[model samples]
Target: MAAKQAERQLVEIFGHAPRDHSSAARTFWQLNACPFIGKECTKFDHTRTICYGTCSVTNAEQEVVICPNRLYENNYEAIRKVGSDVFGDIPFMLFNEYVRIVASGNHQMDCLVALGHNSGKEVKISQLSMDWVIAHIRNQQLVEYVGIEVQSIDITGNYRDAWYAARDMRDSIPASGHGLNWANVHKRLIPQIIRKSLVYSKSLLVKNGLHFIVPEPVYQRFEAIIGANIPLVDRPGKEVIVVHTYDIGPRVEQGRMRRLVLNRELMFDLNEFSKRFISGPNLPPGIALDDKIRSILAVS
Candidate 1:
């Protein structure tokens, strides 16, 4: 019963059918078959287009098409789920705790804030690319802003292509790789972490700092590749928390349907994280910089 509820939620969130192992295999095969496998080259242009499409498959009558990119869609849905889970709960953290939820998404970051305000007129500072933001209030006054950025392995072109390629190659004539090579963590996940962290680190309103949510495997890869070697920047007292997730498979319900669970036990404080991981590039001079500097100087 719980599994059924989870599946329903996942379907609502991802707009894809629930896929068991058998169904997934059939879908993979049908989507990867070439449209002109047995046809002569003279009858069809072999070089122009061979496979039906990477994401979907067409029927014999060509009247209907089936899309099998459930895994890809799952990754996207997972990101949004993580964002919703993290930001949606901020308002209920403490009884009578004044909290304002801002800039969340249904399946992606639609509004990475550009100067918004809460009902109480508290300033909400955010970048155009931030994933989500939450503001905390104390004594009827806004005290801190919390930013969140979510990334997935599917963001990398190589990983995405490899995933499809693996499916397509599984039963091809000249069978090659059977699985995704997987993109380098440094190349895919780290860059996003650095980019999002830099944006949050530079924000003047996010006093509580930013959180980056990623899959556990990606986080482990990041730790293995650059453990205890992160570089430092001048953004003192700023924090970039790294949250890793665990895939609890596709059987349970309530945030468990093909969803990744965040490991709250491990957090990477920027003050300490910067001591090892390399810092992102400095922000170029702009009006925002002037304002940030002024705020810092005033606080000091």
Candidate 2:
């Protein structure tokens, strides 16, 4: 009944015949991206049908837009499988561009954008083929763990605290301050301050390391601290925030893939207002209740 209602709502919004696709078994990429994929269960072309589900039900243009849910429930995958002829690169574009396309053309799209700190970061990737990250997370025996860096337990003063922060207020929160400037900060905000500190303690395998795609503010502060120590490592001439392209690049890709799967991936990272705009609790317009009407009719 719930599914039927969702379908009905979709039909009303789209003003067209809804697709009726289903998954045989869940898949990882399909799972996260399921919310966006709807019914075609056949192809990725939004113009022809709704491409929603794990397994393809037909040869006409089997599109599993979302990844398989088999990995686990609630794990979103941003995958789109069109016909073999459509087997080229996926069209990832800006939000405005997608909107423009929608306005100008008679086509439809399931666009995705991923942005966040390390905690909320999403990954993007093709199925099965590891551009190269699978080995690190799974191989415990072949690799030996290496250096562990102790996180600075202290934080600087004038910490950021905006349960409801304006742009002006958030602007000054991330200014440059020296190491663990504890005296300037307060007890109430200490936990949050320390939690935001750069000092981290995570075990990594030799020839392997963790890459955290932190928020821009965190990135800036990190640059402030580590930027000075960068030149000594290898590229002796430059003073910079040194990040190994090989170490962190793959992880970023993974996070991108994850966002694509979740259907929540935005074409651009939202600002404060945009975030609020998208995350509001408001419901879609309600239909006049027909207590006797079955939900299948909604999609039909």
Each prediction's RMSD to truth: 17.6, 25.5
lDDT of 1 by residue, 261-292 (tens): 34433455665554444542332447888889
Name the regions of candidate 1 deviating beyond 4 angstroms: 1-128, 135-144, 155-184, 228-237, 250-259, 279-300
The candidate maximizing lDDT is: 1
- Tell me the lDDT of candidate 1: 0.39
As a whole number from 0 to 100, the lDDT of residue 29 in candidate 1 is: 38
As a whole number from 0 to 100, the lDDT of residue 223 in candidate 1 is 70
Write candidate 2's Cα lDDT for 1-300 as tens digits. 343311101110011112211131223224323332332233233465333222111111111111222111122121112111122343433234444665786354433321221112222233211111111111113222111111111322221221112112233222212123223212322222232211211223223222211222222333343232222232211111112210011112211222212211011111221222233223233453443254647642
* Residue 263 CA displacement from its true place in model 2, Å: 22
TM-score per candidate:
0.41, 0.19
How accurate locally is residue 174 in candidate 1, as Cα lDDT from 0 to 100?
24
Error of 1 at 270 (Å): 1.5
The per-candidate count of clashes, in order, stands at 5, 37
